[model samples]
Target: MDRIAFDIAHLLAGGLVLVSFMMIYQDRLYALLNVFALHAVLLSLSVSWQAYTQHAPHLYVTAAIALIFKAIVIPGVLHRIIRQMGIHREVEKVVGVGVTMLAGMGLVAMSIVLMLGLTEAADAFAREDLAFALSVVLLGLLMMVTRRNAVSQVVGFMSLENGLILAATGAKGMPLVVEISVAFSVLIAFIVIGVFLFRIRERFDTVDDVALEDYRGEVE
Candidate 1:
């Protein structure tokens, strides 16, 4: 039963990572936010399951934070921001969706290889969990770089942080860093992102970073 719980948690975490990749392909503002909310839900479930399987109640607090902050509050704020900003149209994509997905896959492969080497001779469960976490992190970075939209970049960074939380939970004897830091980091990020989004809207009437490039004082 423990193994079954572990496998279920693994599946949930992997699903969240896959959803993170999908966020890269989204071109609609509302849909992108919805996808992020779904990803958060998956993250909460995964962490809760990890807490259950490992008998680590500390992780349950992490899961609650994810569910409340990421899944509910963040999305609520973003939705209001979008509605008030009048950015209901489709978002701007710097690259074709297919290319972004391919890059995401490459990142996943690289993460797996690096994790396999770094966690060599480690426990089997730790090895696999860390690999997935790294993949989610790298793919999140890929999304941030490839997508030229402010909201999507925020989503990407959140996904990266989610991966870090996952890795922290998987590591043996890990402390409260995941539980505590996530709240602090997310709170800070939300405030910064809120200000940035408002500025983006004020500058271009939209949150598309590509459009904001026109205001860059540097000529290249």
Candidate 2:
């Protein structure tokens, strides 16, 4: 039973990392949002599995928050925002898909090497989960760096947070308050970024980060 539970948890965590890779190659805004929603769904499942295997019920609330807010509400709101701003169909890319994917694979390899080395004395489950979480986080950073759109950058930031949540829940004896705090912090970030996106659109008539940088006299 323990081995089975560990395998399931590993599968879900790996699924989250896989979805992060999928997010990297999405050039269209709507498609990126859809993939992000899928990422959140995978995260929720992973967290719920952690809750079950660890017998920690508060993690369920964390999973539910991921489902309701990250998976549904954030994507829905971002879709509407992009539609209203008239950039729903715009395709934005700052790096070639091949390069970004190769970089992502390197990050994953680095994560596995670093995590396994650091956690040599830790349980196998936690070590694997932490490695996957680090990969997700690094991939999210890569996404943010390789996208010129503010909306896509926001998705990347949220994906990074998903990795943090996964790492927290994977570690045994994590407090409920910490999980709740992390969830609420992400909610606050989403709200702030949503408003920021509108403000950017209002001033520059687009959400391209390059435009905003030029407007601020910053050379990109």
lDDT of 2 at 30: 92
Candidate number with greatest TM-score: 2
Instruction: lDDT for model 1, please.
Output: 0.77
lDDT of each: 0.77, 0.82
Off by over 4 Å in 1: 183-193, 196-198, 202-220
lDDT of 2 by residue, 1-220 (tens): 3888988998999999999999998877899889999999999998888888788888888888889888998888878877777663654677789999999999999999999988468888888889999999999999888876777778888899889888889988687635564666577566647655655452223446665676777874
The residue-by-residue lDDT of candidate 1 on 43-107, one tens digit each, is 88888888877788878888888899888888788787777776545766667899888888888
Per-model TM-score versus the true fold: 0.85, 0.87
